[model samples]
Target: MPLFFLSYSHVPVHRAGRSPDFDRLVFRFFEDLCGHLAAAGGPEGNAAGFVERPGTPAEETLRALADCRVFVPLYAKRYFTDPKCGRHWTAATTGPADTRPAVVPVLWTPYPPAALPRAAQYDLPAMPGDGDEAEEEYAATGLHQMLQLGEELGDGRAGRITAWLARRVLYAAATVPAPPGDRHVPGPLTALDNAFTAPLPAPPTLRITVLAPTEEQLPIGRDESRYGPAAEDWRPYGPALGPLADQVRALARNLGFTPDLVAFDKPRAELRGTAVPDAPWVLVVDPWALENPRVADQVREFDAVRRPWTAVLSVLPEDDPQTKERSERLTRLLHTCFPRFLREGRAGEQNAVRGLPDADVFALWFSELAESARMRYLRYIHSQLSAGGDGTGDRTEGRP
Candidate 1:
């Protein structure tokens, strides 16, 4: 078993529009911390600490958390709210409070002291010198932010602080040695409450509608390779992406949106005349669907209409051979069909509704789509409220 289990929340998606470096820095911090721990532990520290990654066996995590000598938690806003992190913490600190395993809290991000939960706070030893300026600064900046501002992993406060943390973990292993614990936590880890609080309000909704044909409905010569039972299962991106609807749902969840998947068979009346939606909507469109007169009319009607809260995304996978051969033809068809989408004057950024080449591009574009819909909705509602009317803004007459 490893000497320490590095417990932290997993960030699932690369947030849209932010520099990718934020997540890179986070991973680099973890690697550096592990390296520091190993160096401090000497020849015996080959596997000085363990951090879980995707595809790591659950049993391995169960054993490491149960058996490790020290519990090193990486604290951040995400860390507190993640139920998985809570389970790990609960499993590691399984016994009586006084005799619980040694814990070394690694601050990755700062949280207001009062906003902290009992799980992290209760474990902290009540040491004096509470008003110290250096401590306050350290508390405020967090180890991760310090790292972001050119703090090297091996020198200065960042280095020294990490080095001190490593030594403490090593010392805990020596003085309070613990053997590999049984794999079983007292109960199911899933039942454990999250240690830190996630915001209480219901998350905003992102409605996703997949418009495509089922295998049986494909036009004469079209291959049925990627079509599943329904429109939601239309995987224009091929086998690798599975279904676009599911992918959008996962991405939506990562972005803190409650994804509501609407069927393509939804009434046209409801689609056109709705006064306002409780959530923003994204349409996952496969070019094949445009062949069906009904689907195409809906697509064109949706496109020509002035619904800022709706973002239409045309998916024609780049890697798929069938999709590649027809990509240009399909895109041109879209341009001709939906003149408003192809029209040029679309604010500062690229058009929010347009072609997405593949799943990767789809993901990137979907992030923007979600944000665009959200912002447009907010902007419209705000306009209505300021004009001394109910906040239920409708888009019966305008150009998006």
Candidate 2:
């Protein structure tokens, strides 16, 4: 049996003879992954990896999926809908979470987590890349784009990412290998239909604005490591992960909102909450942002004229002791700048954003805040219609 099964939907573009460019890239990637596996002392030659040929029977693919030590699923729009692919995914992931081989999912084409089938949505593990830019590229786009960058597979960043994936697969195989379910089970196991159905409803948009300082705008004496080329690079939570805005974006996506990261410093007509009818704005505030005179002004301006559909989430890191005094001073000053949000949370709590030191707690609060913001937008539209105005809730000329 092959060490891994490369489970993917057979499309004409990815077919061996139909599209030369796609076939070349895919085959090269597969061969390179196999070579990496072999170099790591894994199976070699014909027993290294298995990919079903075009027109292969579903039973053949299912048998390979059942025997592999690891399952590498290339996720795409068509992969979920293909009957054979669905069958493989369902059978491989049916037993207890620990009973199946670890799945290393690749986002061949961009699709929301919500778009995945129920089993896949809960079972797929995250594939973090080697570096920040690389991880962002893989997350924003997919590995298919990386293949186009270099003529040959296993070249440059694409190669590095592939190697990283190969090592992760090998690591999991040795440490957490689980016996796959028997493929010869009777009854519905052999005749089960596709596990997925029609696509789910599109998630609503959340315009995630990051109100933080760029490296150039950072106050003197500040740690430059935390600040990067742009505001989106600000990681208030520390140096462990990506920017706080992106962490929030991932959390937003998990909660069923399509998150859009926007630069708060950029001037746009969409800053007016009513301008974006479908997407509510959520400002992710960095505590040190108040130190800069210009950012402070922007914060006050937003608080003064911001609409109900706009919400603020302030992230204060408890681990950064140096920032504690300065953060408290800013919080006290922030209350005067915006009296409503600062007082509405818990009795002793100055703001809802406080006391959230991690993503789990942040997500719990963000869900309610995002929904509340959406409802406010709907209420505004309803009142406008009830008052015989356009449902857009805005009539003033050039208000933005």
Candidate 3:
């Protein structure tokens, strides 16, 4: 069962236009919230503990609420007005008097306690809204004082909020008793404010050079193959590099890194110019595409460099005998290039590679890769900080 269910209205009532600013803020909040919770051994500390998103089936939402130990309602004026949001609140609190889930109301938007539903009126911690007054209040607290140090070191509001929300969720998760009749109550939760108090680790500035064939290079005109007859259809049925690159970009944003994507055919000087010379580079290789002499030369040039580089070999699905043969050929080609490459597939399966057909499984594999890359980058940053040197460590050859 999940430790808590996060409930919020995705659309705002008063806002006329869909503001990108608001969207970014919310996205960063959840990312940091879950990241911190996972670090603190909360339900979100693992892959299973996921925040419920919009468009979830009503039955599914109810089932999740029934199993969750806490219901966290992100209260805004718009939240109470939405029927779906109201139903979510009702479903969590509506059962038998003793069995209702515990409510942890988060005042995401500043509204009086009277504005909330009668069932949600219990005293709870409220996060400050984005206002000067709230900022002033936060600035007075020890948490804010510690965060000031991070800000001085270049951490922004988003970093501060991540640390703040993580600490808040940790405290809430630790102190709140489990829902009634829960057989397995979690052990005592300890306060780890010190973790937040420390200077926030800056995300390493890295560039991910995606070495793969473009749509024009791939055989999209052939109807017999899975690449499809149309160029646009290639995204879903063709090689996994494009989609995988997109997934990596999305995950990298959540990890606080803005990675630039460089294609295989892009000039080496342009690639060298854009890439951060000191940061780690993730080379996403499309094995079949590497059959091209120019592409092969690019890979060898990148490998020749002595810097830290991660190679991800993209392969086709091995669902049939013919497909299996093709996938094996690609895997062999990958081995000849890197000798060691991470296969994207089910964990612990030897020589398992990602297949475009199983989008869900491949997505999970990419998410894990992005997370591992983030950790590696974080370690690199920490080492630089510990050495009392500026964040830029040693420079590596960026040409490839």
TM-score per candidate, chains pooled: 0.47, 0.51, 0.37
Q: Estimate every model's Cα lDDT from 0 to 1.
A: 0.64, 0.65, 0.48
| lDDT (10s digit) by residue, model 2, range 197-225 | 54555676788888778888877777777
Task: Give the clashing pairs for model 3.
Answer: 38-45
| CA deviation > 4 Å runs, candidate 1 | 1-199, 265-271, 344-354, 388-400
Worst 10 residues of 2 by lDDT: 391-400
Candidate with best TM-score: 2
TM-score of 1: 0.47
* Better structure of 1 and 3 per lDDT: 1
Candidate 1 clashing pairs, residues 3+ apart or interchain: none
Sorted on TM-score, highest at the top, how do the candidates line up? Answer: 2, 1, 3
Q: After superposing candidate 3 on the true structure, give the runs of residues whose Cα lies further than 4 Å from its correct spot.
A: 1-206, 219-245, 251-259, 265-280, 304-313, 318-325, 342-357, 381-400
Ranking by lDDT: 2, 1, 3
Q: Write the per-residue lDDT of candidate 1 for residues 65-170, one digit (tens) a residue.
A: 7667777777777877777987887787665433345666666786432234655542331111233433444555777766655454443556655665666676
Alpha carbon lDDT of residue 314, candidate 3?
52
**Residue-wise lDDT of candidate 3 within 65-112, one digit each (tens)?**
666655666666667666656666656555453455445554465443
